[model samples]
Every structure is written in C-alpha cells, then in structure tokens.
Target chain A: MSCFILEQAGIDAPETLADVLAAAETIRDAGIMQHPVAMVSGAGWNLAQEFVNLYLGHGGSFFEPGSAAPAINNDAGLATLEALKALTSFSNPDYLTFDSNSIQALWEAGEVALMLHWGSRGAGILSGDNAAPEIVEATVLAAAPTVEGQSRPATTLWWDGFTIAANTSDADAEASFLAMLNGITPERVAANSELAVWLGEGYQPTPASAGVIASAEGGAAPYPMTPYMGLMHTALGDNLAGFLQGTASAEETLETIEAAYVTAARAQGFLN
Target chain B: MKHRTFFWFILPSLIAMILFIALPVGSVFVQSLHVEHEQVLRTVENCGPFGCTEETVIDRAATEELRAAQPLGRFAGLSNYTDRNHLAFSELGVMWERSDSFADFTRRAMTLPFWRAMAFTLTFTFVVTPLVLLLGLAIALGVNALPRAFRGPTIFVSLLPMIVTPLIGSLILFWMVDSRGVLGAALQTLMNDPNLSLKASPTLTWIMLMVYGVWSSAPFAFIVFYAGLQTVPEEPLEAAMIDGASRWQRIRYVVIPHLMPLAVFITLMQLMDNFRVFEPIVGFQAQANATSLSYNIFNYLRGDAAQFGAAATTSMLTILGVVVLLTPVLMRTWRDFNRKGH
Candidate 1:
C-alpha cells in the first residue's frame, strides 16, 4: 500500500523506517489503500501478525534457554504494532476473511498487489499458477523485509523434517524407511523437491528452489521455536484484532499479551 | 410389565449411547485431566585433557519404549482446565486482583482466549437465534398467505439457502461480499465510498456472519413453521373473524399459539447449534471478529500434540454450557408433553 502510495504521489521507495511510516500517512490521507482489508483474520492470522512483527525486530524464538520469556511485550513489540498499523492499511477489505489459499487467490486474481505469502508457495508468481506474466517475469528474489535500524528483516525460518520412531521393533528398518520417505535419493529431489529451497544430503534444489536458496543465503532468520512459542503466537493472533481496530491501546494490547503468555507458560510448565 | 422389561427393551439404544456418546465424553474428560508427552533422551560426548572422548547418544528407542509404557503421561488433574488455554482461572484471578474496577477487569479479562471465544459465542447465539426465528416465521407466514400457485416456487427458493451446506453457502456469500465481488462493488458504489467493504470492518463482519447464520438456518425454521402453520385450527380463525379481530390479531393470538411447541423446538435446536458454531468461522475465515466454543477446541486439535488436553477441556466446557442452555427448554418441553398427556 505504501509503495503504491509513494508511486501515486510521485515519490520514491522509502529510505528509512521513518519514511515508511510517513508513506503510511500519505496513503491514509489519499484514501487509496484499503486499511481494513489488511488486518486479515482467522486461523492463519498468527502468520500475518508475525509477518508484521518481523518489521519491528521482535521475532525469532520466544525460548532461548536464558531469555526470561517470549519477546512480544517489549520495545520491539510496541514498535512492530506501530508499523503494523501503517502497513495493514493497504490490505483489501476482506483480508480478515482470508486463509492461505484465499490470499493466494487474491494475488492470482490481481485483487491484491502485495501479500506476505510464503517464499516457496509465493514462487508460483514466478513459475506457474496463472500469475500475471509481466509481474511473474519482473519478480525478483530479494532479501527478507527489514526495518530501518534493524540489520536483518524480521522474517521467520521454517522447514520440514522427519523424526524416526525409535520404539519400533526394528529401529534400523524404521530409520531406513523414514530416510526413503524423506527423499534421500537424488532422483527424488530432482523430480519432486522443486518447491523446496534447501534439501537434505543427496537431494538437490530445483531451478526455482535454487534461485530462492541462493537469494536467501545469509539473509533470513529462523523463527524461535520455543515450547511457549505457540502460547505467545495465540496471544498475539487473538489480541491483534482488538488493537488493530482501535478498541485496545498498543500498551494495553502488549500488557494483555504479556500477562497471557506468562500465565500460559507457567501453567503449561514452560516456566518455573 | 416390570421396569426391568422396559429397561431391556431400551437396552440396545442405551448400549449404543454409552459406546458412542458416553464413552467419548468420559474419555475426553479423562484426557482433559492428563497431559500426553513423548519422552526425550539425548546423549553427550565428553572430551578430557587426556585427549580421550566417549559418546552419549539420544536413546530414541528408550524414549519411545517409555512413552509406550505410560501412554497418558502423568495426570495433571484440573490444571489443564484451569490452564491459560481454557478457563484461565489463575490468570483471571490475578488480573482481577490487580484491577481497580469492573471496567478494568473486563478490559483485562477479555484478553483471555476462553473469555474472548465465550463473548463471541454468547453474542452470536443470542443474536442469530431470534433473528433466524423471526425471518423463518415471516417467510412461513408470507408463503402460507400466497396463492397456491405461487407458494410452491417461493418455498423452493427459500429452501435453497437452508439446503446448501453451511461451509459452501458461507463461502459463496463470502465471495459475493468480497470488496471486488458483485455485491461488494455495488455496495461500494451505492454508498458512494470506494473503500467500503463488509468483510474488512470487525462490526460489519459480525453483521455479515449473523446475516449468514440467519440466511442459512432460516430455511429450516421456515420449513418447521410452515409445517406447524398447517395445524393452525380453522375454528380459532372463524371465532376470531366473528369477534371482528384484525388479521394481525388473528395471527398474533391464534396462529402463534398453535406454533408454540414448534417454536420451542426450533429455538432449542438452533441455540444449541449456534452455541457450537465452528464451520462458519473456518469458511468465512472470520476468527478475527468471531469465534465460537467449538472453534476454540478446533484450534487446539490442530496443534502439534493434537492438544488433546486443551481440546478436551474446551469440549467438556462446551458440553456443559449446552446442557445449561438447554435445561429450561428441555423442562418446558417436558412440562408441555405431560400436560398434553402424550
């Protein structure tokens, strides 16, 4: 929304977080961006919330052994929500009604210009899935989204892996079966790992995956996968709507979230 | 016949209920009291000044063996129920103690997942039920008054909303109300605002969802009331006409009295169904604005461990809540039945 806002006003891409925030004002004033559509809701709202948080540099694992708690209640969190309010203004009016598939459909249908779709899944614009050929061709594998003062984009890392069951009567057999299932064979990766950016040993990235991998190298950061992480994500996802809609202040939202996570972590035995 | 004979006659149904409903409910209650865990066994290697190293490996097999031995893990009792996911009893108490007034308490408590879901569930149930009943009753009365030739087609048209599956129906409506969809575009133009959208605003989304609940469920209500209207006695109509009662009076007193039982039946059924609202939340992706108790359970069930503990807690709470909501209706129906000597 901000990008379009800047373009319409004959301005350039923002150079700093302050500029990006200003661009939000420009768009809000222009009445060109659909702000309500941007606060997409539902089961996957957690992903959307995290996508916003990545901008303020409050993401990654909530449990890093020595860290006291999930880091969603601090300065980074408040900053993220502030930036989030600005960017979410550009989402379509039906954003809260979108799931992964619907969001993808919106992009494919050209109903939306910018969406924080998954890297592997988002690659569809560059390859298949009926994305506008012009947009697809112009698609660039860029670094993760970043905040002005932050060195890295507030992006989350993810992958799929298998854990062989050791309780099986034949551990070795189970391990071998799981290995096969995981596509340890080079041929399997060549044929089927086209959607994956990185694969295990013996598997190679597909042409599409290779490009994304090359671009993301030393760029994206892993999401903090702590025990209390789910609790925190639930807190953020559940409360974000209230804050975004202006029913709750940013401070109230953060405090409520912090209290919820602390209580959950303690109850779930994640905290002493 | 002795009571034993009556019991024997119903024994098969009793057994089936025990197996399907009773057993599952019992198991869920038990599940709510215990957390399931898969043990982790890791090994470490040590390096000494003597330059010798030994290995300790994760005993994955042992961990699985242990898990298999104690599948339910340790029993946590009511902890899961009081845990932050469901009741958040401890959290609520703490927040309450810290807060200065009811407004503050409410502000803080609304943050709890259970309270939030409860608020939506209660609001939706209360809002949708009356609206559905009213729409259904109106349609029934209108259809009943229509000429015989027109009634059939009108009835068919109304039945379409009720007959289509809820998820599919909601999706179809969702697309239409989408900002770019036909209705959405028309609405935007009609309002003379380019940014107007139904699905975007929290209030608008709730209204849309409630409208959907009525649209989809009203047909069932219409069907029931239409069938009930057939039983409205001609004697009362004749008596009312002779007494110079208005057409409105005839319906207000005579037609409604006749449909009371059916109204009770529909209200009880819808209240229960709406209280457990889940599919619309998923189909509409409206969790940002609306969530029901069943959806809360569903969210947990989709988690890594199946979140059996939390899901069961929510399920048990929902079941109890349904029982609470139905108690009066059930008693009223029973009283009516006994009075009717049925």
Candidate 2:
C-alpha cells in the first residue's frame, strides 16, 4: 500500500490537497524548507500510478463502461493535471528526474517534507543508517490528502498475495498453498507485525502502518484491473512529462495520451 | 582461388549467419504482421486482504481456447506499422492538414512517439558520429606525438572511458550532473542560474547524451587510428621532410592520406553503433526527453502486457533504419574496392 509520508517537524500534517499547497508558502516564507512536497513526474510507471491516484480522487474513471475507449480527457482529468502542476510548483526544480529511488533519497536526506511512497519503505526510513536522525524522528505516515468534497484519500490500494503456478501438480499446489498459509499464521504475523502493514489475524498496527490502514478505512479505491489499463498506463507514463515541462497544455497532453492508448490498444487487439 | 574452394571455405560461417541472424530477423518480420486475439472479458470477485471488489479480468479458458485454435493470433498485415505508435501515416496527414504553419506541423508531429524517438535518434547519430571522429583523431595524434616512455600510460589512461562499462559510466555521470551533485552544482554556479538542471530540459538531456556518446566511443576510433599510425611508413615522411614540408604540412599531406582507409572503417562502425544508441538513455533515465528506436522496442516489450507485435514492428523498422543509414558508406567502400581492382 502507498500513502503520504510527511515530516512533521516543520508543520502539522496536511489533511487536504489545499492544505498541502497552503502549507508550502508558510513553510517557505518561514525558512523551514524550500520545497515541502516531493513528487515524481519524469521516469517510470510510478508517475502514472500517482496520476491515477489523483484522478481517482477527483472521481474519474479510465474508460467508458464495457469498452476500451479512453474517458480521461474530461474535467476530472484536467483538474488532476492542474492540481499536479500546482503541487510541482512547491516541489524541487529537478522534479522531472524524480523516480522512486531518487525521491526516497531526497526524503532520507531530509530535503523534502512530504512524499507519497510505498509503506514497505517504512523499515528503511525508520532505521536506515543513511537517514538523518531528525528526519526519522519527525516522519509520520498518514493517508494522502484528498481534494475538496472527497472523503477518500488521494491514493490507491494494493495487496501482495501468493498463487500456485498452473503447471504445478495437484500435490505440489497443495503443499505450496499450505506453506504460504503457515507463513501467514496469526502467531507469525503477530511476531513480525512491524515489518509491514499486515492484514492477517493478530497483527497490530504500528506508526509505519498507520497511513495504509487509514487510507483503506477512508475508502481508497484499488487500482483498475482492466486488461487494457496497462496500455493506458504506458501511454500516460510516456506522455505526461510534456505537460509537466510546460511544453504541452493539459488538453493537448490528454489528447496525446488518448491517441497513444488507442494505437496500442488496436495493436494488442483490445480495440479495432 | 577456385570458386568451389572459396564457397566451401566460407560454408560454416554462411550457415551460422543464416541460423543466427537471418532466421531470427525473418521470424520478427512474421511476428510484426500479427497481433493477439481479441480478449474475452469477464467480471469476477477478486478477494484479497482488502476485501473483494468486482474486477474485470481476462476469461482465461475462453482466451486460451481462442489462442489454441489460432496460435499465431489474428493477422494484422501492415497495420502495426501505420499505427500512431509507429510511422503514424494517418496522424501525419492530419497534422499537415490541420496545422497553420510548418513549425506547427513539426511541433504536432513531435508529439507522436515514433517521430519523437526518430528525432532524437537521428540527431544523436548525426551529431555524435562526426564529433567522435574528430576527437578520436585528435587524441590519436596527441598520443602519437607523446614521448615513447610516456606513451604506454597515456594510451591506457585515454582508453579508460571505453574500458568502463557504458551503463556504469553513464550512471556515474548521471549522478555527477544531478542538481546538487558536484558537477551540477559547479555548472549552476558557472551559469549564474540556480535552476539550471541538466535532466529537466529536453535540449540539455539530448546534449548530455551525445556528450556521453562521444566520450565513451572516441577511444575505439583512437585505438584504431593509433594502430594505423604505427603502419605509416617512414619513406613518405622522409621525402616530405627533404622536400621542405613543415610539421603540419607533413601531417596534412602524408599522415592523413595514410589514415584515410582507417577513418573510413571507423566511420562505418561508429554510424552503426550511434544509430542504435540505447544504454546511456536508460542509465541516465532520459526516456522522457530522448528515446531511440531501440529504446522504443525495449519500452514495447517491458511491463506486464508486452506488445509483441509493436516490439517486432519497431525491431523491423530499426533494422531498416540501420540499413538506410549504412547504404551510402557501404556503396562508397564498394566503389573504392572496384576502383582499386581496376
């Protein structure tokens, strides 16, 4: 699961996207931190994933019902892009080069006060040798802020599970399933609860797991599982940077993404 | 040599080329003409730790039945090449018809992935090839002029860029050119602009990629020319010296002519290598700013749902690009060979 990880030393935790943006000026004016937010707009699929979180927060869906036609070139899409551009105004100038690894580095170095990252990174941030002591002590995990009138946090839900291969024998599949079941038993889950935000019985919530739990309880939607969503993701990842760079408008960028997705969908037989 | 004897001598290599090179390319061409069958979709409850939600999933049994019946997938013909992700012929026509000016047309065209990658690839190939040749020749000459005792260390030091792996070299440079990194900080101070980020701008990223291309590849041309320098006989030099030629004149006259063939060889190799530029873009994570045909193919094949048809089409297009780029050099070499024979 992913949610907002904020450094609380400089300011109270932001509860809404407006609060986050509003806090940026106060933090900068008071000489607390120049950039309060760290977002990825440049490399990898994380940017697209983040975009989906923001778009869904604005009540947007990826496709028309029962079809592969893209429905993102709408008001929600434009609002999401505009919000992202506003957030970037308070982020580092080198935000275009930001990816998972680099943003994590910035967080650990205490350069950025807020970031949206995976909960699995909690262990490293809490006890990693590279992280500054003050930053570690001040770090707080919370559900990502939502847009106005939205109760759910601006984030998506994800889960990790085990599955047996189709080619495995019946006996082997049974053994594999038994092993996985044993691994996630209540007793074992209680013992290793701090390692992750576990959903197994007897697992207790820790500060590190707070964000994921809160987000799940707040009705964060799961990422879309449509077959053609992968193509949409690739198109979004490839094209969104142009808008963030100020070279393309939100409409133009969304149009490019739709065109790209349609072409890829046609090639993959998801569209004619 | 007898024709039959020559044919028998090259028989092993000919078979190896056919098996390794020709067959794979032929299969890629065939794959480019087909696409996956239309998927059968079904809504199912996907239970997980975070409760069950109705999700759209591929109906595996139905899809598998379709695949089993027609294993090669639905035939797509040349539609993959004409799609917006590849050549984008129809999109280009739209851009031409709708745009108000030539610059507007070009700007709209660059928004297409195929044209965007092509712009970077062609620019990288054309810019880096000549720079590599010039820098390599300069280094070769400077090293050749060094004292015999210092030459060994100098040559070794100069070859370090090529000796280091390209990916690692680019990654190190990527770090150094970060906004807060040593080189990046120094560049910012020098330019008197706090916001001068090398990775943020497309033009800067293109320049950095080409700079890396030249830095890593110059050593290859240098070593080739250095070896050729050793073979430049003393007879012409002595004659030129006796005829009152200056040092620059001697080099311009005799040394350059002797190195002409080696320059041609280096140019041929460099053009092919630069046209397929891939590693540095990935290492630097510059895909947002610059992507080559090879990078496009890599992108198509990556992630959960690999577009095999798109990847194959890009592969064929890349092969075609390399052939077109090399044709002039190949024809010139052939003409030179014929002239010498005559």
Candidate 3:
C-alpha cells in the first residue's frame, strides 16, 4: 500500500495531495523541521517511478493503444511537474541528491516530518535501533495521498519473485522451482508478515503493511510494463531536472523528454 | 641490440597488446556500427499478485529466433555515430540555424547529451590539469624546503589525498559539503546566506567537481616534481647562489629548468586523467550538473536494459577524444625527441 509515513506529533496525517502540501507548510512554519518532505529527485528509475505515480494519479496515460510513442506531454504531465515542483519546494534544499538510502536516513534520524517511502522500510524504521525513539513512537502509516479530486492513491504495486533460467535442464528447473516454493511457504509468510507486504496466503496484516494495503484497496495502478518503457523512464529521469532546477519551463521540459525518449527508442529499434 | 634479438624480446609484449588492446578496440568499433534487432511485440495477459492485465511485452521466442538468424543485429552503418544521442548533426544544424547569437546556440546545444558531457569534460580537463600541475609544483617546492627532520612526515601528509581511493575521497567531501554538513554550514555562515547549497547551483557544482579533481590529482604531479627536484644538481644551485640570486631567482633559474620535463609528463597524465573524470561525479551525485564521456558510457551500460550500441559508440568517441586532446603535447614531445636524436 502506498501510504504517507508521518510523525504524528507534528501534524495530522494527510488524505489528499492538497492536505499533504498544506501540512508541509504547517510543519515548516511550526519549526518541527526545516523541510517536511524528503523525496528521491535524482536521476534513476526511482525518480521516473515517482513521476509516473503522480502522473497516473492525475489520470494520465503513458501511451495510446498500440503506440510506442509517448503521450505524456499533456495537461496531466504539466500538473504532475507543477505538483512535484511544489512538493519539492518544501523539501530539503539538497533534495536533488536524495536517493533511496539518503531519504531513509533522513527519516530514521527524525530530520524530516513526512515521507512517501516504501512500506518495506517500515519495519526497519519502526523496530530497528537506528531511528530516533520520538520518531518511531509517533510514526503513523496512512494511505497514500491522492491528487485533488482523485480517489485513487498515487502509487504503484511491485512484486518480487524468482524465475528459473530457460536454458536450465528440466530436472534442475523443477528443483529450483520447488525450492523457491518451499522457501515462501505459508508458514514462512505468516512468520515474516511484518517484513514486507506479502500478497500470498498465510500473510497477516501489520501496521507496516497498512500503507501498501490501503493503497491497493484504493485502486492504485501497476507500473507500466512495456518493451520501450525503460527508455522513456530514462529519458524522464535525465531531462526532468532542468524544470525542477528552474532553468526550463514545464512545456519545454516535456518536449525535451519526448525528444530524448524518441532518440533512445529509435536507437533501441522501438521506433523508426 | 640485433634486430632479430629485439624482435624476439618485443614479440611477447606485441602479441599481448594485440590480444588485449587492439582486438577489444576492433570489437567495440564493430559493435558501435550495429544496433539491437527490431523487437517483436505482442500483447499478453500478465497475471500476478495484483490481477491480470493485457501487457505489451517483447515476444521473446520470436526475438530469439531473429537473433539466431542474425547474431550481430541490424547493421546501422554510420547512423549510430550521427544519431541525436551521439553527434546529433541534424539537431545541431537546426539549433545553429535558429539561434540568433553564439551564446544562444551554445545554450541550446548543451541540452544535447553528447555536447553536454563534452562541455563539462573539456572544462574539467582544461581547468583541473593546469591547476593540478601548479599546485603539485608548489607543494613539491614547499615540501622540499622543509628541514630533513620534517621532510618525511610532510611528504607523507602531502601524499594523503592520492593515497585515499578516488571514490571514497570524493564521497567524504560530498558529505562534508552537504547543506547541513560542516563545510556547508560554514560556507553559509561565511556568505550570510542560509539557502545557499553547493549541490543546487550548476556553477557551484562545477567548481566543486573541479576542486575535487585538482585536490585528488595534485599529488601525482607533486610526487613526480618532488622526485625530479631530488636530481637537481647542486653545482647549478651553488653557481646561482654565488651570482647573488634570491631563493626565488635560484629556483626560477636552475630548479625549474631541471623540472621542465617532469612538468610535461605530469601535464600529459593529468589531461588524460581529468578528461575521463567519472568517480567524483558519481560520488557527489553531480550528474544533473556535470557529466563526462566516461560517465555517459557508464550511464548507457548500466540498469535494466543496457544500450550496448550507445555505450560502444561513446567508448569509441572517448578514445578518439583522448587521442585528439593528447595530440599537441605528444607532437611537442615527438619534436623534442627527434631534435635530440639528431
């Protein structure tokens, strides 16, 4: 479930994107923290995923049916970028350098009041020794906030599994599959329910899994799965920084992303 | 040495170089001229923990068959070199024709990946190389002037930057320059600006990267100059001293002349090293502000889908760039060698 991990002592948990932004200002003004939000804005798939999550929350589609061409240069994209720029405005000044590790560090250190982080990190922050006790005690996992007038959470579902190599012999493949199955047996899942938001049988919901489950129940979309999506993600990650840096306009940034994606797609033989 | 004996002695290294260097370059050139096969796409129902959705996936079996038919993929000829991701000839032409001023043209051109990397690479190489040489020479002189009792410790301390691995050294600096870090807070206080962030502004980021480059590489130049300083003949120093030359004058007259060749050696190495700056960019997370040809190659080759063709083209172009950059220094050295041979 995509949920906001908040320090309850600072502000009430937010239910919508508007609430999140509002709370961000309140947290800053109250001096609970310098920045209320910490996000991954650096170049990587993580940044692209963050953009896609917001873009999808605004009811945007990546492409039209049967088209490899990107169609994100639209109102949804502009709104997404604007929203991102706004969100980042209240974030740490060095938010551009934030990655998976740094943002978690900020959270554990109780340096930030709120974050949109993976549910998997919940256990480590809550039960792990590193996090400040004040933060751990006050931490509340709520459903992922949504864009204005949107009921669906602005997040995506991810699944981790093992796949056997195609060239492996049938006997070896069978053994590998059985071993994987045994490893994830219902007993194991029940024992490790707090570790992650597991979907299979014998999994019991915990506070750590609340955000992800709430997100799933709220109709969050899965990440886009297509042959050329990786290229588009890379293009977005590389080009979106200019707009965030205040060097380029939103429209110009979108156009550049489109051009960059087309160039990569052509090289990869996804486009003429 | 007899020609036959020379050939036999050098034959082992010749074979090794051909096998290691020449063959790899040849393979990269070939790879750069080709791109992946056009993928066969099909819509399939993907069922997982969530639910079933019709997903667009590359038809793996068909693609494998295509690959089996033609292992090297589709030959792109010179197209890969000329693509927008590479030289971007067409895009450059458009920018050139549309822009009113040189600065406008340069600004538009910097938006392209190749040119952007080139700009930073060239700037870093030019800025860091000279700075390293000067700093290195200064440090060498300063250390050399120290008393024998302190010389060993001073030399060791000066060599500390070079001893630390480049990535770790840069990472340590990266943390220190964070907005909340020691250096960063001091800078903010010094400037009386609470919002000034080294990672925020492109210009500051460039300065930071170049500073790191010079800091990390100066020791190489220093040690070389220091070693060269040891061999400076005492006779010239005495002659210059007897001529009533000042300490500065003595160094300028005798010591510098003795160290000129070492300066050339250091400059050549620094230019080559600085041109391929990669670790600091990664460590500092400065890609949004600065990137180099080596970094671009790394970007292309990493992640879920590796762009082998793009990486290969960048590699070939990087080799070409290194050669072009070293040409003047190499030419001067060749001329000097020829003159001496005569």
**Best prediction by lDDT:** 2
The iRMS of model 1 comes to 7.3
| Runs of candidate 3 exceeding 4 Å displacement | A1-11, A166-170, B97-101
Question: lDDT at A98 for candidate 2?
Answer: 81
- State each model's CA lDDT, in order: 0.69, 0.87, 0.86
**What digit string (tens of lDDT, one per residue) describes model 3 on residues B214-324?**
999999999999999999999989998999999999989899988988999988898889889999999999888888999989988876678999899999999999999
Native contacts recovered, in order, as a fraction for each? Answer: 0.37, 0.75, 0.62
The numbered model that scores best in TM-score is 2
- B-chain TM-score for every candidate: 0.90, 0.98, 0.98
Question: DockQ of each candidate's interface versus the true one?
Answer: 0.34, 0.72, 0.67
User: Hey, what RMSD does candidate 1 come out at?
Assistant: 5.3
B118-160, model 1: which lDDT tens digit per residue? 9888988999999989999999999999999999999999999
lDDT of 3 at A138: 65
lDDT of candidate 2 over B1-342, digit per residue (tens)? 899999999999999999999999999999999999998888888876667877778889999999999998899899889888899999999989988999888878888888898999999999999999889989999999999999999999999999999999999999999998999999999999977889888899999999999999999999999999999999999999999999999989999999999999999899999989999999898987898999999999998889999999999999999999999989998999999977
Q: With candidate 1 superimposed using the best TM-score fit, by how many Å does residue B156's alpha carbon deviate from the native? A: 2.2
Q: What is the TM-score of chain A in candidate 2?
A: 0.93
For all predictions in the order shown, the interface RMSD in Å is 7.3, 1.4, 1.3
Indicate the DockQ of the complex predicted as candidate 1. Answer: 0.34
Summing lDDT over every window of 10 consecutive residues in candidate 3 chain B, give the lowest-scoring window: B103-112
Candidate 2 lDDT, tens digit per residue, A1-272? 11223333445668888888877766767677777778766555877887998999998999998788899999999999999888888888778778877888888887877777766676677775778787777687878788998888888887777878899999999999999999999999999888887877989998778888888888888778789999999999998888888778899899999999988888777888
Kindly report the TM-score of the first chain in candidate 3: 0.92
TM-score of each: 0.83, 0.97, 0.96
- Model 1 per-residue lDDT tens digits across residues A1-272: 22343466555554344554465466556665544122233334454445444633544334433443656566777777776666565666455555666765665554543445456654565575687664455343443446765655555556665556656568787767877776656666666566566445555655445334643463554444334456667656667777766768888888877766665455444454
